[model samples]
Target: MRRAISVGRDQLMSVGVCFGKFTKSGKFKLHITALDYLAQYAKFKLWIKPNGEMQFLYGNHIAKAHVGRISEDVPEHQGIVIFSMADVPLGFGVTARSTVDIRKLQPTDIVVFHQADVGEYLREQDTLF
Candidate 1:
């Protein structure tokens, strides 16, 4: 995928598999495949407990208590890829609080705000190409 993307970057311009697109403000809103790809390379990630995996797939935000591990130095409002403890890419979201700030948060406090998830494929199958 990397080779394909890099090779066609200049010539293709608007064709090929899209990972995601940069917003006007320069934030890269990740697509599911992009999230999965970045999960192995980027530090902005969260591995949730099993109990929360289903909820997250259903488009619910993650709570502090449900988080099993968080990558270091994640800032608040940063886009992050969500994963199950077994390392499956489930979705993506924005952090509600920084890694440091989470220390003072309650168990029920919102951690990651859901943006997209695998369940959306099932829920929106009719609209999906």
Candidate 2:
């Protein structure tokens, strides 16, 4: 015979979820879960085309040609959430150009540098669980 064990919400809270952490240099590093929560409230966002969505899921940066739309005032080097044109949250990255600067960018120029992506959940499942 065996007994099943159950943990309470307080127990889970004690273990704590690793949302993010501040680095030695004081920069905050966000985990994928945190990115998902923050995506909805993010001021800057990039809605990318299907091709870009696939590339982004593969951990690649976004190029200008693949951008479907951009939020009005995204500044250069600002952290922004990436989304599919259909409005699914995909990942997050830092903008390579500001709204004004991007206007002068070439089609192939990098628009966003990949930080973290939803694919990481599957790719890092072993470590997560």
Candidate 3:
């Protein structure tokens, strides 16, 4: 099943794969994707700091804006995507952008933003038995 997330007036910078309570790390692996808002493509990986901040690993980059949170549900082994409001075209491929504090997130609470690129990908690809 496919789900849509409303980013609202604020733009998002990166998508996060929150492994809520399932892993000991207590952190999410934020990822950047190849598709632009207009559907153009590029490639690269970016890493996220421990404090939920974003940085680039191998190319010139733009700073991310801090947006308020929106809630959505993610199934097992699922993730969410974040989009940049400022129109900073991201490099292609999935990148680890940063981590988030998952302490207060309940199993039902939307721990990860459910509209990110990686989240959408996971929802589309079925598991091969």
Candidate 4:
């Protein structure tokens, strides 16, 4: 059995939702992210049918992505890409395409996404230089 990891509220910053087909299965599905208040922490949840297609309840809202990362240096070109687990782009769903640096994130924000089991892989302090 795999051990459950502890996640800190500091690591969760923003939320993102996406829909796409897994490369191996070629069926549609949804991906959700719960970001930490600092916008530097993230947790991901993926929901898909055995065949890879999303359940009917998802509707035409096929794909989405949200920025949970708060950085003094936001990317000049921000956008979302539909990709496989390998991080290969299947297609483009939406794009922010511009940089917007918001105020530093706080620790009480809550983001809602599809329900899926999330495993904590890394702690926020571990990523610090």
Candidate 5:
């Protein structure tokens, strides 16, 4: 039996539980507790369209065309946060391309913070208990 750790809305993007953490790399995945804490704050994030969002939630690799927007500071290797078009934190990803290169990126190019990969490990954990 594991308790769901609760964090404030202000802390959602910046907070992590025992399950994950955000270091020099971008943010890790949000626990079920904070995934809903969308709105207000926005930084180090990338917004993907519904198609991308579904694959992201389904745990598929992200592509450039799938990304609609991104934070200004997202650099190569930086752990950028993943978000749904609705502003929910979908997961984590590492930038394969820098902000400058993103403008000319191809649809098949990858993006950052792919932890837990869609909703596998996280989803699996919930169903087990």
Candidate 6:
């Protein structure tokens, strides 16, 4: 229902779904394939290096140094699309830091994108399919 509103398309034909909640900004948030789908139109995007990919997949925070590129105009609270070096959206999250602040941080310092602790969510999706 929300995806139709966010992206403005509502021809969904799925029989069942396992969706998460929405960000305060009113963007519907989900993990996995939705990231790739949203990447098509979402303006705010950030990418991480290969080194950070493993930890990111395991649901770890992406550090400042690991981040490759992020939209400069994105503010601190807006939702951002987290992508890979290969340009694949990895997940979604509200930005905890602005672009300028992220630029001044040290390599190991945490930047943002608090990947949700969705271990059970992923496990549930696996079983549902």
Instruction: Provide the overall lDDT of each model, using Cα atoms, as 2-decimal numbers.
Output: 0.84, 0.85, 0.31, 0.27, 0.66, 0.70
Over 4 Å off, model 4: 2-21, 25-30, 33-70, 77-95, 100-129
Candidate 3 — which residues are off by over 4 angstroms? 1-33, 37-53, 56-67, 85-129
Assess candidate 4 and give its TM-score to the true structure.
Answer: 0.19
Clashes of each: 0, 0, 12, 13, 10, 0
- Candidate 1 per-residue lDDT over residues 36-127, each given as its tens digit: 56667766989999999998998899999999999999999998888899988888899999999998999999999998888877886664
Candidate 5 residue pairs in backbone clash: 26-79, 59-117, 59-118, 92-113, 92-114, 93-112, 93-113, 93-114, 94-112, 94-113
Candidate 1 worst ten-residue window by lDDT: 8-17
Best by TM-score: 2
User: Per-prediction TM-score, please?
Assistant: 0.75, 0.81, 0.22, 0.19, 0.62, 0.67
lDDT of 2 by residue, 1-129 (tens): 012126655554334457766879999888787766778799998999997788899889999999999999888899999989999899899998998888899999999999989998988766543
Candidate 6 error regions (>4 Å) = 1-33, 116-129
Superposed on all Cα atoms, the candidates' RMSDs to the truth, in angstroms, are 5.0, 5.1, 17.2, 17.9, 8.5, 7.2
Q: Candidate 4's C-alpha lDDT?
A: 0.27
CA deviation > 4 Å runs, candidate 5: 1-17, 21-42, 126-129
Summarize candidate 5's per-residue lDDT along 1-129 as a digit string, tens digits: 122247556655543334444557786544434333422343578888888777777767788888888888567886566778887666665688888888887778776546544476566776422
Candidates in descending TM-score order = 2, 1, 6, 5, 3, 4
Which regions of candidate 1 deviate over 4 angstroms? 1-15, 20-30
Residue pairs clashing in model 6 are none
- Which candidate comes out best when scored by lDDT? 2
The ten-residue window of minimal lDDT in model 5 covers 31-40
**True-structure lDDT of candidate 5:** 0.66
Judged by whole-model lDDT over C-alpha atoms, candidate 1 comes out at 0.84
